[model samples]
Target: MNLFATFEERVAQALRNLQQAGDLPGDLDISRAVVEPPRDPAHGDLATNAAMVLAKPAGTNPRALAEKIAADLASDPRIVAAEVAGPGFINLRLDPAIYRDMLRAVILLGEEYGRGTGQDTRPVNVEYVSANPTGPMHVGHGRGAVFGDALCALLAFAGHDVSREYYINDAGAQVDVLARSAFLRYREALGEEIGEIPEGLYPGDYLVGVGQQLAQTYGPGLHDHTEAEWLPVVRDAAIEAMMAMIRDDLAALDIRHDVFFSERSLMAGGTDAVAATIADLRARDLIYEGRLPRPKGAPDEDWEDREQTLFRATEFGDDVDRPLLKSDGSYTYFAADIAYHRSKFERGFPVMIDVWGADHGGYVKRMQAAVKAITRGEGALDVKLCQMVRLLRDGEQVKMSKRSGEFVTLREVVDEVGSDAVRFMMLYRKNDAPLDFDLVKVREQSKDNPVFYVQYAHARCHSVARQAAEAFPQADLSPENLATRAAASQTAIDPAELELLRRIAQYPRIVEAAAKAHEPHRIAFFVHEIASLLHQFWAKGKDSTHLRFVNQSDEESSLERLALAYAIRCVIASGLRILGVAAPDEMR
Candidate 1:
């Protein structure tokens, strides 16, 4: 059960009861009120701003309204105490039985405990990791890939119908460069001397295989052709090869997109989707012909002052009107991007999310404006910009990969430390914050390594269960049996054990909040906290044998503690699964 949501409903019901009793104004708005854990755990189990939010509307002071609400809530059997603190916040101390019941629920539900039900099921389109199909994915692309994949999993767990999408950027100048580079490799593959890759071309050895494939398929027929005649054939072949390599890299990290939307397809088949989008906007008066002022710090030759077809971006919320067409009459990149997102709206997705790199921070507002303009304000676009990741070994920076000849490849890192470590460390920080990923720190088998620390907690829980089974061979250690026995036992839970239970109860709230905010790092931070608490409790057991999970002389106490450990294992495993990491049963 969602404990916070349950109390939120109870708080709202209290307000309605006051309205019926002629204490609070019936027309007062209660939607603004919220129930959440207090900033200080010492304050209470839960806190609500119901009275504070409703006071002004009811023509009363907040403190005075809080007193009335507290009195009504104190009568609840589940609430042990309801105190009004500071300026009108109502702090509620729930009965310990409430939390004990939550533990029972956790074991009963297992991994599905925190999963949402009957929430906003809107079709959400999450477009992420749209790397250009010109080369193998770099470390920066891996960061975005993991972040997007985790966010999709979080949304799905929160009960949204999410579509994972990758927008292949094949219709650009970069692919042309790739085709030219592959042609050079093709010549080399056919026994021609093409030494020292020219400037402005990809120098990666990865293209050599593409070249070999071309030679094996078309032989020397394309090598003697003109650049214009061979560019398309080579570009298509090169892009296909690059995408296959990219897919292999993504699979190394266990990320798979539901849709691979091709940007080239937007303008393909002689039907220009970009032009259609522009025309649709023109009919809506959201497009015009205008000239933009020279951008600050732009070189004189780079700044064009000619009138051009532009989108009225400022009308929707962008800083200025954006040009949709260049001087050569070709559509701009933004024009094609606008059509791509419009297609998402047309495909019945009113909620769209784009996960981009930090460099695209400035492009966010214009794209949001376009979505609003095209969807007539019915669609909402949320852009999450993930900052770059700096790879380091010990203290010094890691060198570039010889395979890609530019940056460290994603596959290289995954292959080195395993996908679990790569994925967990990638999500251990906020997407907008610059992360310094230390290669040595991630592989360490200590508390300093969060991924190891968290997974070890799961492994430790299994160890406890095995020990308990050996100590009492006749005991039924199954989840259902343990939960039933735990509920019936009269042994009092220690303070540390109760604290651990409280942390486990907060999982559902964390999942829902992280999903709503589009932040997967929150889950990483949360599971680490659970692991820390479990380790602390285990340490206390070492110091005091009475607190141990498996006590041979006290089978009843052992059964209850085993149930608690089972709950912790389930929660940590569930959280790691969402982050695309594994919760190993045993760590060597």
Candidate 2:
């Protein structure tokens, strides 16, 4: 169903024929050869760089090889013409039947139309939205959440067994801080008005519920207990409460993780996986006691030359060897993270992808290094760094401060603007770039908003379908009927329909490429392009009565145009599903 791939193979077979005929060398490498849409549609349906890629290796003139390849390709029934264009490029003009058959294939396949040879499935663990269990999720975390969720969906569509994971930052000082913050509220709940929240503690009213729960459970029996006596009880309560709130926030956007792995669990249950991982590394001589460089770009006033337990991360492509334990003999966050990833590997996930915030950019190389050393290069780790997000309204920046306990939560954004807007707008751009999320523009019901525009295309397609059904009640407008026909009605295709088909046919390849490149933003762009084409065609129908999808006088032509519209709806729906956005039948 992938025409480009089909034609690429055709070109390769032509090359092999030339080699067998003794006209070209058999050692020519065709890996770089590609078949794709021409720069200008008027040039041809598809173009290939076979001659240019193989000419040097084959020891032949570029144009001469191109001519030979063109001749061989022209022999194919589907390829109507293949001409040598500028500097040995071959522009292929395919028979219109190829496109008609593609439309037929689309109608026949429906949602499964563009799915490529996703190659069975590979176990991929996509860990995202691993926000600290201190408070509700923030905007930056929301970006990574949507990107990762959409990525998992894309991978699934491309046949990957994806595990949506959330790594709780619960085993660290932050959770203890969360407990202290809630303990202040607990005392307040017990009628002792604790003054302003102390510094280095979470300052949020969300933890007030945890305080109430503590007051109800222990009633004032533990009010006078020392820090050691109450720390675990209160810390565990706060983490559980905060994680509940986090899950609720994520649910508002309709996102759910398959696994919520706790960092504390790595060292819990009387089994310290972190220690075992370090021991394994120590046995391999990758772990050692060493001293690290004092400082780099920032000031480290208390820099010490003390020896610490370190991992030889440099051997696995890290900038420097990394520490496995903190000065207090407790395993570092990196140590637990290494254990978590090693566990993922042991659980049969050889491919691990972490969608992290931009601030974690410096941590990527080291994490990749750890995965390599732990799995002995059998496992691969790819970290996607999501940049900051600036929420804007009326062209003005909306500032927030979580330290002041006043920040925009992911729940608030989704509740106000709806999940569809939040999901689509988050994926409208590449994750690596900073995004300016305008509150006003995304909700606008105009072409200015991509989400609205793309959804409108799907709506418009269905609207046209309904109209066609109403106008031609007796016409055989079933997908089987319309698709089985040569044209919509045997009428010559307007250039617009041809252009739309070309773009429609590009979906399968786009899915495969985006899945391979790990970019779901490509789907957003493709949907928008399809919408624009449909809109252009709809606009054209206003001036030309014959261009209108409904033809009361010619039922066959009407069914054909409606068939095209239905195909467009199918594509937009499939593409939108990949983006985790709904493709409504009507744009209400």
* Best by the TM-score measure: 1
Model 1, global lDDT = 0.91
- Local error of candidate 1 at 59, Å? 1.9
lDDT of 2 at 278: 94
lDDT of 2 by residue, 372-475 (tens): 99999889999999999999886998777553287877777787788999999999999999999988888999999999999999999999888887887776
RMSD of 2: 1.9
The TM-score between candidate 2 and the true structure equals 0.96
Q: What number of clashing residue pairs does each candidate have, in the order they appear? A: 0, 1
By summed lDDT, the worst window of 10 consecutive residues in model 1 runs over 295-304
Tens-digit lDDT track for model 1 on 1-588?
888889999888888999999998888888998998888888878999988888988899999999999999999999999999989999999987777678788899999989987378779999999999999999899999999999999999988999999999988888999999999999999999998999999999999999999999999999789999999999999999999999999999999999999998898889889989999999988888878888777443323798888899999999778988878988788999999999999998999999999999989999999999999999999999999999999989997899999889999888888899989998999999998888888899999999999999999999999999899999888989887876676677788887888788889999999999999999999999999999999999988988999889999888889999999999999999999999999999
TM-score of each: 0.98, 0.96
Q: Which pairs of residues collide in candidate 2?
A: 488-560
